[model samples]
Target: MTDIQLNMDGEPGWEPFDAPALVGASLRFVSGDRTGNRFRMRYFRNASGELVARVWFGPETEGPPGHAHGGSIAAVLDEVLGLAAWAAGYPIVVGNLNIHFRHLLPLQTVVQVDSEVVAAAGRKISVRGRIVLGDRIFAEADCLCITLPEEQRRQLG
Candidate 1:
């Protein structure tokens, strides 16, 4: 097993997210799975308050050759983009997720995911995000999220 070193202190213009606060709260499936060990994700918020995540694709996520699986990439996009909506103050669940893969991501590589809430109309929210390694974009995603009903939100809380 390879040792993964993470900078717990976030990158410039961003702040580390409190993952424990979200576990079992809104992101149970993704953030609460401690045993699968497919990825190590660190969340942050940019200076403009957009949600961002720095992710390390672990060996457990391998697919074609030494690259990360497409499904793993999509999972990251789903969680990051969904949390982006929540960070924007919309209690939401993903209604639709569309991802375009631009390049193959290598396993064990740390990548940056940047997300922003693009539009909001009533209960529907549109978010755009991308996974990148420096100047190269690995994938881009657009997500439509639906706000949970007040009753459901209260039940979750």
Candidate 2:
């Protein structure tokens, strides 16, 4: 039997990050199933402390034959981008996510999601991210997030 690769914390220069620690089960829809075939996601922080994710789109996420659905891709972006804000110490909820699909993503392929917190203005935070495999960019998104109030933030956790 072949073992499924479910986690990536041991990769060089990457550290394991627990999103559930911050938001409880709020991110469960996209990233919750670690062993399921729908989506397999492993969260990490690179050497620079930037949030990154290794995500696999399984057969259940397919739209076109052999390819993943655009909605599936967008959902991953929404979760990761919003988590990017939380990882950067801003407890936030995604208000808007603008995505541009550049290429079709094949199901069962692992791709990297790299995210950055670009700007912050009072209660608002902007995050930019991409789903890519090496030099090939599959999708890119800019997420607008709003900082949650202290009470609301505590409730999320």
Best model per lDDT: 2
What does each candidate score in C-alpha RMSD? 2.5, 1.8
**In model 2, which regions exceed 4 Å deviation?**
1-10
Give me the displacement of residue 24 in model 1, in angstroms.
3.0
lDDT tens readout by residue for model 2, 60-101: 999999999999999999999999999999998899999999
Model 1, range 79-144, lDDT digits (tens) per residue?
A: 999888887789899999999999999988888899999999999999999999889999999999
lDDT scores in order: 0.84, 0.90
Q: Ten consecutive residues with minimal summed lDDT in candidate 1?
A: 1-10
Q: Residue 46's C-alpha lDDT in candidate 1?
A: 82
